[model samples]
Target: MNKEYLIRWIKAAGIRAIKTMAQTAVATIGTTAAMSEVNWVMVASTAGLAGIMSLLTSIAGLPELKV
Candidate 1:
């Protein structure tokens, strides 16, 4: 792919990753009974993992983008 396509893919992947991370974090936080009892570290780690997975998935092939 050319530089433009590559750049677009990267930007899209990054946004996807951020969205995934936010979703994961929110879901994880929801699992807790109360906000005060939430484990910030665990939520962050889980979200970070999700973001990495998103990026990896993008590398494989972004379903949202057509070939």
Candidate 2:
């Protein structure tokens, strides 16, 4: 793969990871007393899901932006 393609993949993955983490955190906030008490499994699963989604989207050549 080319350098530009690799950079795009990395950017997409990072964006996905952050978005997943935020969503997971919001979902966990109501059930947990503190951030430290949040479920590890949920966090890991969210990350994994984000990674898979990013990879799939990248491969599918989906537009990352629209205006």
Candidate 3:
């Protein structure tokens, strides 16, 4: 397993996580707008988790793993 490969994997994962978070955020907002009363807490919680995942993935990508 090359270090560079691991780094690349981490970078890819980070990108994916970010994209997923964005999509989820958009969907949640759209749904909330459509509904009169949305579970704000749930939406916030999920978004928070996604944000954390994105951050972790980004940090992992930062490590200069031998690619």
Candidate 4:
């Protein structure tokens, strides 16, 4: 892949990863979750895993990916 395509893919993947992380964090937090009682480590790890999965999935196919 060319530099331009690589850049575009990175941007697309990054955005997707961020979105996934946000969604995961919200879901993990839940409506009844208390801030003080929240499992911060669990939430962070779950969100991080979701983001990483999103990034890996983007490698299979993404709008910005030429191939």
Q: Kindly list the per-residue Cα lDDT of model 1 for residues 1-67, writing each as its tens digit.
A: 9888888899999999999999999999998636668898999999999999999988988876776
The per-model lDDT (C-alpha) reads: 0.91, 0.65, 0.71, 0.87
lDDT (tens digit, per residue) of candidate 3 on 1-67: 6777766876776667777777777778779878876777767777768877776766655444434
Please state the error at residue 51 of candidate 4 in Å.
0.5
Q: What's each prediction's TM-score? A: 0.87, 0.50, 0.59, 0.85
In terms of TM-score, which candidate is strongest? 1
Instruction: Provide the global lDDT of candidate 4 against the true structure.
Output: 0.87
* Worst window of 10 by summed lDDT in candidate 2: 58-67
Worst 10 residues of 3 by lDDT: 58-67
Clash count list over all predictions = 0, 0, 5, 0
lDDT of 2: 0.65
Residue-wise C-alpha lDDT for candidate 4, range 33-52, written one tens digit per residue: 86456787899999999999
What's the distance in Å from true for residue 63, model 3?
A: 22
